[model samples]
Target: MYRLYYAPGAASLVVHWLLIEMGQPHALQRVDMDARQQKSAEYLALNPNGTVPTLIADGRPLYEAAALVLYLADRHAEAGLAPAVGDPQRGEYCQWLLNLANTVQSPMRLWWYPQDLHGLPEDAVREAARRRVEAAWERLDAHLAARGPYLLGERVSAVDFYLVMLMRWTRKMPRPGDAWPHLGALAGRMKARPSFAALYEREGLSEWR
Candidate 1:
């Protein structure tokens, strides 16, 4: 069984939702942020970054939500959440996932924790990060307009799960994820899934539903 170290509705939610989507058996170990449990030696031993959504797979710990999703999707190919290796779509699949991580998700770090980036006024840094996020949404919205109902178009993939959760993080922003037409439609479809409702219950998330 896989084990996930997470905090409710955090980055861990993506992994949690994917596992349920794949019908994978997993155990959750919450790292209490209120208690600073993530910084404790034990938790740091498992994940040096002390971040949520670390998965322990086959007795080894894995960090990074994107990597974990990639691993799980590939390993459980029968779930059909990833394009198989050598499939023509595989390259595009990797590109979308990596773009989600490197382009948008990195900026999310600064958006959520402006204190991490030094030297500038925190508010300015946050505003800059917010712009980056909105730009990402605009690009993604266009992509969805052309190629989506899901990220892979017609068939849902793990990348779609990742996208929905990332968009959820932006729910409180000035122009939220759903403000874009395609993204709004995509979010609506994703939310209609049984797994999404279960995630809301599992994470105790009452807002943005």
Candidate 2:
């Protein structure tokens, strides 16, 4: 069984949701962010970065929500959340996944935590980050429009779940992900999943719901 250290509504939500969706029996270890527990030396040992999520997989520790989710997708291939190695859409899957990790999620992080960037005024930093984040969503909105229904065409993929998680992060933004109609529809579909419902319940998230 996997042991997941998480903070509700944080990036860890993606990994937590994946475990539920995949029917994986996992233990939940709460990292109290309100008390700054993640920065403690003990927590650092598990995840040096002191992040909300540190997945203990078969005695090994893993971090990074996207990576953890991707790992779970690959581990539980029967879930069909990821395309097989030789599948043509596998390339597309990797591209979209990595792109979000780099471009989309990156800016959103800076937007949320401007202090991480330092020096610049917080407003200026968020203003710039906001445009980039919204543009990234605009690109995705078009992609989803063209693809229709899901990120990988007809069926769902882990990437769609990942996208939904990110979209929720943008809920308080000037133009949230759902502001883009296609993305809004996509979010609607994903939120309907029992796994997502469980995530909301566990995380005590109400706004994005």
Candidate 3:
């Protein structure tokens, strides 16, 4: 069984939701981020970065939510969350996944913790990050409007899970991701999945429900 170390409604939400959706056998160890448990020496050993969503797979520690998403989808190819390696859509899959990770998710970190900039004006940093995130949402919404019901066309993929998790993060933002029509439709479909309810219950999340 996989052992997942997570913080409720954090980046770990995607990993937890995937586990539930894929019907993977897993156990959870909720890292109390409010109490700084993720930074403790014990947790640090499992993930030097001291982040939640540290997963134990085959007795080896794994971190990074995107990498974990890719890993799980790859290992369980029958779940069909990822395009097959030789498929033409594979490149696009990796592209959007990396885009979500690099462009969207990274800026969101600044939006949530602008204090990470240290010496800079937190407000300026946050506004810049917010703009970057909104640009990403605009681009994605257009992509969906033109070519989607799902990011990968007709079928749901692992990236949809990643996307919805990020969308939920924006629920409290000045302009939420779901404010975009196509994005709102996508989020509705994803949230309707049975796994999401379990994810919310386990993570104790009520917002954006």
Predicted model with the maximum lDDT: 3
Model 2 misplaced stretches (Cα beyond 4 Å): none
lDDT of 2 by residue, 1-209 (tens): 99999998888999999999999999999989989999999999999998878999999999998888789999999999999899999999989899898878999998899988778899999999999988898888899888867888997999998898899899888888888999999999999999988888877888888
* Range of the 10 consecutive residues with the lowest summed lDDT in candidate 3: 199-208
lDDT head-to-head 1 vs 3, winner: 3
Q: Residue 73 in model 2: shift from native, Å? A: 0.2
- Candidate with more favorable, higher lDDT: 1 or 2: 2
Ranking 1 against 2 by TM-score, winner: 2
For this target, which candidate reaches the highest TM-score against the unseen true structure? 3
lDDT of model 2, residue 105: 90
Question: For model 3, what is the C-alpha lDDT against the true structure?
Answer: 0.94
lDDT of 3 by residue, 1-209 (tens): 99999988999999999999999999999999989999999999999998888999999999999999999999999999999999999999999899999989999999999999999999999999999999999999999999999999998999999999999888888999999999999999999999999999988888889
Per-candidate Cα lDDT values, in order, are 0.89, 0.90, 0.94
Candidate 1 has an lDDT of 0.89
Q: What does each candidate score in C-alpha RMSD?
A: 1.0, 0.9, 0.7
Model 3, stretches more than 4 Å misplaced? Answer: none
**lDDT (C-alpha) at residue 107 in model 1:** 88
TM-score of each: 0.97, 0.98, 0.99
